[model samples]
Target: MPDIVDDKSEQCIRFLLDCLDAHRKQHAGDDAPPPPFFLGLNGVQGSGKSTLVSLLKNKLESEPHNLSTAILSIDDFYLPHSAQQALAASHPQNPLVQHRGQPSTHDISLLKSTFNSLKTRHPVALPCYDKSAFAGQGDRTPETTWTRVNGPDQRSIDIIIFEGWCVGFRSLSAVQLESKWSAAVGANMKPAYAGRLGKLELESVTLVNEALRQYDEVTDMLDAFVLIDAEDTQYVYAWRLEQEAALRRERGSGMTDEQVVSFVNGYYPAYELYTEALRRGIFPGVEGRQLVFELGKDRRVKDVKKI
Candidate 1:
């Protein structure tokens, strides 16, 4: 949340404001009631998704309008660490722990319910997930919980920004190269010293296919989709490392860099595959589709192409 104008986050905020302005103008003469705008912002880990949302909220709050806005992150829906630990124990040999950032780890029902309630202009309780503890903190809820203002003079919510690493990603079947089985075995074996483990591969592709269908439902509700295209997987990896380092320092865990890298590796394959699809134009969310910005390696606009 630094007030650095040069940062990509600042640019993202400006873009969102421009969109809101256009929306207001387009509906200026319409007698039809204006619907609440939902902006979906997606990016890879450490791609400034949360920072951009915070900046957008600040910008909106400063503007004089009855316009109420809320920012929701998919991270808030992460399964508690205890739930994750149970899964790991059940399938000790499986790489589900590494699947933390993947679609399989999110509670789709909770997300769908939250969105449904928000659309109705009702007060909705948003969950808060703790990153360090890998569980829900049960406090520190969203500042502007969705609520309908009373009276005919009440101003309606003009915008809602739903941002997350995989917000717009369509869940697909887990595609594991046969070559990766050996590597999976090696990684899963390390935890045997702590408890008995079972050898399980990635979740069946059918589950992934079903998850993608759920993602489709979420996207179908979006008014606009913004993708934060990372330069490459290497860039995302570096950003994640920096974040993890800061997190470990704050917790005083004294974890070595090697240990952190090893832990992060578990979630790397899924992220790499998903981002590769974006680069190759095969991403279901962006194949010849609209995008808010085409971000590049230098964190500058590489091109402003319409989706």
Candidate 2:
């Protein structure tokens, strides 16, 4: 809030702190959950998720909360490039399985163990994924360089800012997928499912929904959830395009424009489905613990509302 992110980050921190303080009051000491007060953040690419986490960490650590905060990202939990290739090979026809953007691409078991260590207040080496590793295909960084959280000096962590594009997403039922799911794509939306590919898309959606069930362990442990929601959700494409353009300017090379479009296609389906679930308050315990910050075309907060 103070050093980075947008002005609305201050407001987000205030709301988040209020929620966290209330949780601590209600469940302190032995009554509290094993993990610290977990705050899950959900946002599309280029929606400032990373910057907001950095600003929130700075603000919380600087404030008088008497807190040691740690960070865990769903991005950091992606399976190594080799494992990802194996997953694709196992399900050759499933579009979702052919890429790293879908729910099944993560190592949920690793994430669970990380959460378990946090729950025990033990020193845990958080996992990190190198987006540029494996010649830009992506892989996990070596364990020695991982951040060791909650050491003797830092003592115990009071909170964890768990964030990613799909942090709090819930799996849909098979009936829901075949029935009302396509409508979740909303108007003016055209995904990869056109003509004959529509059947394969539906099959891919079914497979992806099943894989999402494993993440319930992580989402079930959340004390609070927040969304940096783009008004149309379609803006994710433009937002991510700008991000690639900047990378191109900086390194003079990155994903080609066509490659960027293809990459976005890999994840856009899930965004469409899960955003609808969020709007319906379908995520377990999301009712009062959730807040939405709606952003406009320029990525500025247009409204903040509790769901």
Over all chains combined, what TM-score does candidate 2 have? 0.89
lDDT of 1 by residue, 163-215 (tens): 88767665444343333434555656785422111233444323443455676
Model 2: residue 291 alpha-carbon error in angstroms: 1.4
RMSD each, Å: 6.6, 3.5
lDDT of 2 by residue, 1-307 (tens): 1121346567777778888778867766755464578888888888888888887888888857556788899989999999999999998988777867789999999999999889788888999999988777799999998999878887788889999998889987888776645554333265643222233457778888898999998888888888888898778888888888888888888888888878887787777677877755535554567778888878878888876
Summing lDDT over every window of 10 consecutive residues in candidate 1, give the lowest-scoring window.
193-202
Model 2 clash pairs are none
Task: Give each model's clash number.
Answer: 3, 0
